[model samples]
Target: MARQLDLVDFIVGLPMPVAASPQANPLDLLPRRPKAWERMVAHVPAEDVRISISTTWTRVVVEQLREDGCGDQLRANGSIVSHDVPPGLIWPEPCRLILMTATSAARIHKRWCLEEAPGTGLTNTFRFARQQHADRAAVSQQLRLLGEGQS
Candidate 1:
């Protein structure tokens, strides 16, 4: 004689659902915007760096560097400075300003990581670095041409 099936037995007898297939196109998986508090950084040769905080729509300066509980802190004068840039905020001079999320200073504890842009954002570390390098090279070339003309 067949035995009555218990709840656990019935559940165990059910077929498992098939896992969804991965997307065929990579672009379809891209995020709409960067996650909040994503870290971004830029290394500039200038004595002071200007940052435009998108959230507050204000500009701040990083005149010096400090090590603190928040890892590497950029300071203006004596106070620690931090900036926040929301998604879709087009910095007037994106080439000159380095934008980051506020928590970039408070949370992430790596000095090198603090100097990198968020993996996904309006601008990324690789692109920003390349642009800065290109800009410097262009200026150098222009200067050389002017010197040659004068000679």
Candidate 2:
């Protein structure tokens, strides 16, 4: 006993908010960017070298690099991550890349990155991956496809 429709709205009527994980002590979106930068240095070990960075959007690069990261110690203490790569792992480069994206290039420039720390050697794989509304676009596309299929 259900009615069927032939069209769907890609936009959800009520959108959920994009909030920081409270378990990680959620922060305002803007502040989270800088915090991510510091954590990138700490969480990723020195032995792991950079293979390729998607784009030059510094903050997004930093944010994605924190994929392997946990918690927000960096934000609270203002320190970079300091983890050690295991002995056997060959520092997964080439395959390991960070994808950073934002609405505009100009916005990405404001994240206030600490630049390349002089002593940290340029070998470290810390870079950005840019996307054009990739996340939202992907979700919308998926929803649309689902709707079309249902019809």
Candidate 3:
């Protein structure tokens, strides 16, 4: 006859590793911030434009111009400004705005296209739509270009 094991018996038979000290706080599991992030935060203004680049991609963030409804005016003028930003990317130093050329915008669009997965149809479509908005911003003289060092 075969030997059948109960729940407690099976659990007892399983190998267990030695236990370490428990964490005092859950936040202790979070990774430490990089030195670059500290430097950038110290130098950059909250209201300025910032571009963060990584090994695989780049991200642009434009802070909302709250004083005198300037952000609203910019939006009314068809500017491409976004206040919503995802965390994790470290922003560079604050920069002055420079007019973005259509050529440059096109290059940016091409880069996004290359980076996006071709298999993700819906995601690709959404990204393409965003690229079109950027292209429109370039045409409307509302797109701003960041220098290489700023990124």
lDDT of 1 by residue, 1-151 (tens): 9999999999999999999764233112111222221122233222122222234323343322221222223333334444454433442223333333333321211111122334323332211222221233433343344334433
Compose the digit string of candidate 2's lDDT tens values, residues 1-151. Answer: 8965544543454577998643211111122345356444444542231222223433422322323333222323344444444433433331122322322212322332111222322322222223222233333343344334433
Q: For residues 45-133, what per-residue lDDT tens digits would candidate 3 score against the true structure?
A: 32232222222222232212222222211222334443432332222222322122233433544433212222221221111232322
Question: What are the TM-scores, per candidate, against the unseen true structure?
Answer: 0.20, 0.21, 0.17
| Reference-based lDDT, each prediction | 0.32, 0.32, 0.30
Question: Quick one: ranking by TM-score, best first?
Answer: 2, 1, 3
Number of the top-ranking candidate, with TM-score as the measure: 2
TM-score head-to-head 2 vs 3, winner: 2
- Candidate 3 regions with alpha-carbon error over 4 angstroms: 1-68, 71-98, 113-151
Candidate 2 stretches with Cα past 4 Å from truth are: 1-75, 87-91, 94-137, 140-151
RMSD of each: 17.1, 18.5, 16.3
- TM-score-wise, the better of 1 and 2 is 2
